[model samples]
Target: MLRVTLEQWRMFKAVVEYGGFNQAAKKVHKSQSSIHTAVHKIEQGLGVKLFTVQGRKTQLTEAGEMMLRRANFLLEEAAKVEAVGQTLGEGIESQLRIAVDEIFPQHLLYKVLEQTSNQYPLLRIELMESVLTGGSELLQNTDVDIAISPVVLSDGFSEELCHIEFVAVASPDHALHRYERDLTLEDLKSHRQIVVRDSAIARKKDDGWLGAHQRWTVSHMTTSIDMITKGLGFAWLPIPAIQVLLDTGRLKPLPLLQQSQRKAQLHLIFKDGDRLGPAARAFIGELRYQCMQLEEVM
Candidate 1:
């Protein structure tokens, strides 16, 4: 059997990584002779020269370079194992599941996740994108640790995260834009309206104007916005999601006599606010910071 110990592999890596056995021993708090002996054992066991003297400096052979790369990957995995243990010792959870409303800014979520990964590399993340009351329902059932939605739960813990602007919009060429005066609910009744279904299984809600005789209901905000932007129907959509499209003239606001836009208060909720883990708390802070950044860009 070709038996190779971790100590031997580590010595190989240490010599190449720290540029010399003497330096590697100093960094790892071991004597230079011990590191040299370990490396010598590895070379003899494999019957190959791992390092070659090039002038005054020691250089790795091709086989040594390949082994060094593989060693790095193993060391990284070992570091992750250690990180998980350390975090758990500090009362941090192994995984954080967060439920987010479909209307929330997707870019902001990406930014928050990017930052969180840097801060907690070993923590696992599970993100659920829900529509309307979907996120709130998950919170009620204890399916997620954090819930970010417009619906405020009556119990547990909740705090206002941010305000999302829902603007009534349609394709630029839609019939609603042909009107000479401010449109009314009666005017909207003549056309088709795009409606997004509430994601809650039991507590579904009938939100916004449903006066239109012809309407199409979709399960996601993307589908609803796609239908409206394609001139299939008109509906209110969150500006953070469609601001670029709106700016590019793909959609226009309905000339409503009133209520052209509505501000929805989004809140962050935790099942046990007082007992939240370190990772969950850090994620909430990242969420708030990223949302504020998105607001400035929007």
Candidate 2:
């Protein structure tokens, strides 16, 4: 048997959050006396003083601080339980929103989407192709149910999806390839470097090396690849995306002394695993399965 009721804990939290019984009562639309009584009952049940009044200001006691932390977790779990019940009763979600970084392999992404569509034909999916921190920003803002990004959010859960290899490359006719010897950082600094812009509106930043004397920033990776292939600039391109270009001699690897290749790990991020609907879970499962297949073949 529980000594303190969930309602009592909620009222206690309300008083603490709103700063006083009167304020909590106004916020919760309850009588001040009732709010005070609920909090009192909590303290009595726990055998601890939860708050202290000093000059009309209510401050949490040492025990109150500890209790508040536990109370918060308890309430959050309770809310999640109720939410799960509602979701179960409501059946599958009508729409799913996902933010995927452009760096993820297109074939695998398409395959995953195709499999998910086959499972939920009537489900609507809003896929947002993001770059760099763009997917993370969307997940943080709760604009997307899931995100595939190189960046991991501090408040969200993430699992390593796959590693993407980026190789420094340029067109065969580009001036950089004219160097007979292994290139140094100084040798590449004089040339124009093409880069994709970070898609995040707030807290935007650049990733990887940006040491070139002249820089050309584009919004999409395809644009950067196009510019590079046209000898407009040189940039590090993902191996999977430019594998055909590399094989056909359209793009040649830069002969750097070291650090010519870089690897970035992409992660699948979500706020809560338990909160995901069947559709979202199916998408994630398909993605993992496809990645495993790729690994086995490689």
Candidate 3:
């Protein structure tokens, strides 16, 4: 059995990631000699040359590539273990950056943040309200740890959470609901309409899915809601987002497209396949759990 120190494996993984010991040492806050020595010890223990050094630059051997794969797995598992302990312990100061679309309300999210802050007193929460499309791109670039977006998931990312449904709504005085029967796309087109500020909405119209022209556009759902409250136009909104307004009779369900209203999806997106940190993973868990609870009621 080969026994490799965690530090040695870390040095090796750093070298693989950075492509050189000198750069790896700088990143790990260690001297280049120290990193070289660690890798040397690992190679000695395994009885294989891990790297092919032509000069100051080095390339990974077959053994190096194999070890790199295992080393990264071990490092990730160890990080999870460490993070689990840190999560239980109090007073570990950390910062978490999260991006969310405006579909979710600040008051509700603030409650979640308050609970997290109370439990993890030292954790600082930084929130940014990014539109769905822009937020997805930010998540792909790893600019934000996690993002709540409405895009369908694809390869190279994880859809950690999604449970909300989109519903068609309008103000009580809107013409769509006055007929007391389901409204057709033809009826919707007869009136000027407010639409979500997304290029995708227009594309849907052009494709005949919406079958109407939009009279106005707004950046956020709240803007749409506000506009509808003042009788601007009807639009689709997340059920949970507009539930309060609906309950208060500020908004009325058109139910015109009830038969065709497909549930829209909201996804919690992450970068690099599965390299999520503890804070990011925990937040994803909470968001999923809460959304699941909401789904039960719907």
TM-score of each: 0.86, 0.69, 0.59
State residue 171's C-alpha deviation in candidate 1, in Å: 1.2
Candidate 1 lDDT over 126-224, as tens digits, reads 999887788989989988889998887888888887888888999999989999689988899889999989889989988887889998999988898
Tell me how far the alpha carbon of residue 67 in candidate 1 is from the true structure, in angstroms, after superposition: 1.4
lDDT for every model?
0.86, 0.91, 0.71
Tell me which of candidates 2 and 3 scores higher on TM-score. Answer: 2
Tell me, by lDDT, which candidate is best: 2
Residue pair clashes in candidate 3: none
TM-score computed on alpha carbons, candidate 1? 0.86
By summed lDDT, which 10 consecutive residues of candidate 2 come out lowest? 81-90
Model 3: per-residue Cα lDDT at residue 236? 69
Q: TM-score of predicted model 2?
A: 0.69
Clash pairs, candidate 1, are none
